[model samples]
Target: MDKSNFRFDDKVVLVTGSAGGIGKTIATAFGKAGARVAICDINRVAAETCLKELRESGIEAMYFAVDLSKKGEPQRMVSDVVDAFGKLDILINNARAGERLELLEDTEENWDITMSVGLKASYFATQKAIPIMDSQGGGNIVNISSVSAHVISSGSAAYHVSKSGLSQLTKYLAVHAGPKNIRVNSVSPGLIVQDEHRNRFKSSDNVNYRTRAEQCHPLKRVGYSQEVADAALFLCSKAASFITGQEIIVDGGLIIQDQWALLSNKTHTTDNI
Candidate 1:
């Protein structure tokens, strides 16, 4: 494959919640593609560690440890990225907050946290980035959503609602941002297993959970952060210049199955949820 098609030289990228997991992977991918990256997350230690890793890999990167849940933080982070990189060309809204409670059991605090980080922060950050992107001609945005936005899962009521809102927000922003030459899209990952999950699956105790997850998808395997990163990278690349206001589902065909098949597959266990 001609790798040059995805080259992002001279571009500046800011990835929220890029301390670890899918966010970190996406940030690293963009950096490797020759873009200066700003790694933003609430976790100071993890953000610093991610920055160190990127530097070690010879990728230009900076770290910002700020809580997106707070008012003005999202806008401030965008400003900081612009100050550091001169201009921002790519924005990936990957930060997320969730509570594992059912709708009735969910609290106001939990709902606020979920919305603040998952949806509100992404919305405001994009709002701040639009003008900067417009001034520079154009830019790209990829919001990291989840399959939960489409499928109902037990518990995690706030998380589901936040993701659904995010997917819709992507469409809404794409329509308005399109006039400014900015492209907005989303990637919805399903059953992506990060470091902690890999470790858990290593133990004999959680083997059933892993097996059930694999069976839930047509690919017979759970996804990885890298897979989701690939989708995000593609959407941010010139390859997707004409694609906007759409969601690319990165699930292993998990969403295509009927509700009855999913329930029969024993994939709806609280553990998987």
Candidate 2:
């Protein structure tokens, strides 16, 4: 592949929830790849830090602090980015919520918050960005989905459902936007460790928890934020001009293996030894 094909020079990219974790990585990657980056996050301090980092790296970047769960904030965010950059070429809906409640004990408030951030924000952001993109002759929209969309976990009911909706939303947007040359897609990631996870395992004994968790995956290691960022970049680049309405899963092959197969492999290894 030509390295120049991945460049985003002079292009404007807006990434939501980009203060830290996967969102931060995606925003930074775009900046480094020559795109004018717009970083949006609910946390002012973290957003400032990310913005500073991007600028110091000689990347054109700006920061916006907005609560995406609000009714008009998504549109407002898109407007702000366009106001700053003069044009929007790519939109990455990477923010998410609703990880604290279990299905049986879930509240309406929790569900609303989850759906608002994880799903609705993406919808309205794309709604607002489409015209701008169309005017610019076309653009890319990448929704950061989750493996939860396909595999169900015990506690995260709303989170899973919201992601499922996001995947479907990606397809719907693709169908509607294709005629206008606006491509819509998603990247679904699994078990990528971030700052919060690192903080939780800072203690000496708990530090090995990540290693233990990595063993469960076929790759024998967890994924990094950069991996997901790379996938997003590819989907948005001209390299994927023909691709739309699809999802690329970055799971280290964890979701493909069956419990029976894993157990059988372990049993066979023990017997062979």
Candidate 3:
């Protein structure tokens, strides 16, 4: 396939949560694709670091610090991207509340903040971005959902609920906006690992948590940040122009597999007899 098919030359992309981890990787991918990217995160320093990396690689990039949990912050984020680049072409909603490990003990405050930051931010950001897209004739949105949204996990109930809400929001926006040529979609990742995530999940050591997590994946490994970013870049580019309201799963086949390992049982023929 021609690499040009994936090129996003001159397009202005707004990517939220793009300081480090999955968000940073997605920003870099868009930059490499030739899109002018805005790296927005609550951490300005980290966002700027990502922007520097992109610039060093000869990509047009900028950085912004905005808290999505605040009202109007999303709109301002969109506005900053538009103001910098003159038009908005792609929107990647990649920010989420920190992973909640407790199922029942997670507070309602935590849940509300998660929704406000993740699901609510996407909605308001879209609200502010759609008009710009319409004025420019069309665009796309990629919501960063998680596989936990579809599959149940014993952990992080609030995070799971927020992602599920965002996933449905992806569909609703797609339905209403498709006629206007703005495409909306979700990319759900499972067990994506980066240095930061690895450190966060590390436990005192019979075996590293990563190895354990990797074993659970059908592919026998967790995915990289770049892998998820690649999926995001494709959905945002012309290559996926015909795609909308789709939930692209990048879970290393874990989503499809019934079990990660074959179960073994010992049976004694003499005992059975």
Per-model TM against the reference = 0.93, 0.93, 0.89
Which model, 1 or 2, shows the larger TM-score? 2
| Candidate 2 overall lDDT versus native | 0.90
lDDT, candidate 1, 183-265, per-residue tens = 99999999898854677765789888878778778778888888998898899888887999999999988988677856565
Best by TM-score: 2
Q: Model 2: clashing residue pairs?
A: none
Local distance difference test, per candidate?
Answer: 0.90, 0.90, 0.85
Worst 10 residues of 1 by lDDT: 261-270
Q: Over the stretch 129-174, how does candidate 2's per-residue lDDT look in tens digits?
A: 9999999999999999989999987776889988999999999999
Q: What's the candidate order when arranged by decreasing TM-score? A: 2, 1, 3
Model 3 lDDT tens row, 1-273: 667879999899888988888988888888888888888889977777777788999988888789999999999989987887899999999987655769758777787778888899999999899888988899999999999888987777878888899889999999988888999999999988764666565655636766767766767778888889889888877788799999999998776664422343332223545
RMSD of 1: 4.0
At residue 173, give the lDDT of candidate 2: 100
Provide the lDDT at 110 for model 3: 85
Residue pairs that clash (backbone atoms under 3 angstroms), model 3: none
